[model samples]
Structure formats: C-alpha cells, structure tokens
Target: MAKALGIGGVFFRARDTAALAAWYEQHLGVPGFWLQEAGLTIFAPFPADTDYFPANRQWMINFRVDDLATLITQLQAADIPVETRPDEWDTPETGRFARITDPEGNPIELWEPPAA
Candidate 1:
C-alpha cells in the first residue's frame, strides 16, 4: 500500500517571492529546503470557529526550534515583534511557543518541545 511518508514540502505564493525567500533564509536559516532534525511533526486541523490563530489568514506555519528564547531574541533584534503566551501556551507535555510574522504578515509559530 503506497502512502505518504511525511510532509515533503510546504509551498505558498508571495507577492515578491525572491524577497520573501531571502527573508526566510536570513531570519530563520531556512534556505528553501531545510534539513530538519528528526522529531515530532504535528498535523492537526483547528476547529472552524477556533481563534487560536488569526481568522483573516487561512493557515499558519509551525516550526519546531531547539531554542525558542534565543530565536525570539534574534527575531526581536531584527525588529520583528514576537507574540508570546507563556501562561496559556506552555506545558510539561507539549512545550513553549512564540509567534511572529513575516514581512508579508504571514504568521509563524516557533515551538520548543519539552526537554526529553
């Protein structure tokens, strides 16, 4: 039985594709195709009426990071505002999370799974 192993890629359109790609590379170190570390990959769909993320946007991208705090600092240094909800978002089972937006206003979630 042939089946999909994992998410091969995530493709999206941008107004200025080149500039957006460069922003991703410079800020997130994601050079188009990244060699992500082997770990859990969440594939959950939110409820239609849920307000977890912005309602205006159709989707949000979550990236698992080794160090969320460090990334948040770096992002802030680059003048990107990071939205954090430590009280409500962090947990012993899951992890800490922080949110940021791209130059084009695309929401990005940075997650750091609880230490194993």
Candidate 2:
C-alpha cells in the first residue's frame, strides 16, 4: 500500500490573512510556500480534553529549528513573548522547546531535536 509522504501545507483561518502571513515570514521565516528542510515531522492527535495548548484553539503548529536560543532572543527583541520551560520541556534525548503565540492568538511550537 502507498502511504502519505509528508505534510503539503497547513491551512487555518486568520482575521487578517495578509498581515498574519507577513508576520510569519518576518518573525519566523515561514513564507506562504516554504521549502522546508528535510527532517522529522510528528503527526499527533490529541484528546479532546488535552491541555497541551490553548483550550479555545483546535490545533497548534510545530516548527523545528536549528538554534533555539538565538531564535528565542530574536523573537523577544521583536517584542514577541516567548515561553520556555527548560526544566520541564528540555531533555538530552528530545532537545529544547519553546512556545509562542501569533498576533491572532495561534500557538506555535519551536523545537530543536537532539543532535545526532
């Protein structure tokens, strides 16, 4: 049987699509049609009552980065609030993680997988 290859795109509603798109491009370096580097992509389905993300939102997007510390600093310098849980979220096996929200209140996860 043939299996799905990978995620083609992510679609969601935004109050101002143009502004939101630009914000992503400027802050996170994600464009409308991004050519992402090949890496691990997780496909998880959470329970309805899961509190991993905001209760008001149905979905969250995760993006893998090479340098989490630099990215966090850049985001903070741009006046964007970034949440990190080093003690609770980071590990030698999994790597570091950070969380941030878009202007429209969409949760975004930044992950840096452990080095090979």
Give the clash count for each candidate.
0, 0
Model 2: lDDT of residue 1: 100
Clash count (model 2, backbone only): 0
What TM-score does prediction 1 earn?
Answer: 0.96
After superposing candidate 2 on the true structure, give the runs of residues whose Cα lies further than 4 Å from its correct spot: none
Global lDDT of model 1: 0.92
lDDT of 2 by residue, 31-114 (tens): 999899999999999999999999999999999999999999999999999999999999999999999999999999999999
Off by over 4 Å in 1: none
Query: What is model 2's C-alpha RMSD?
Result: 0.6
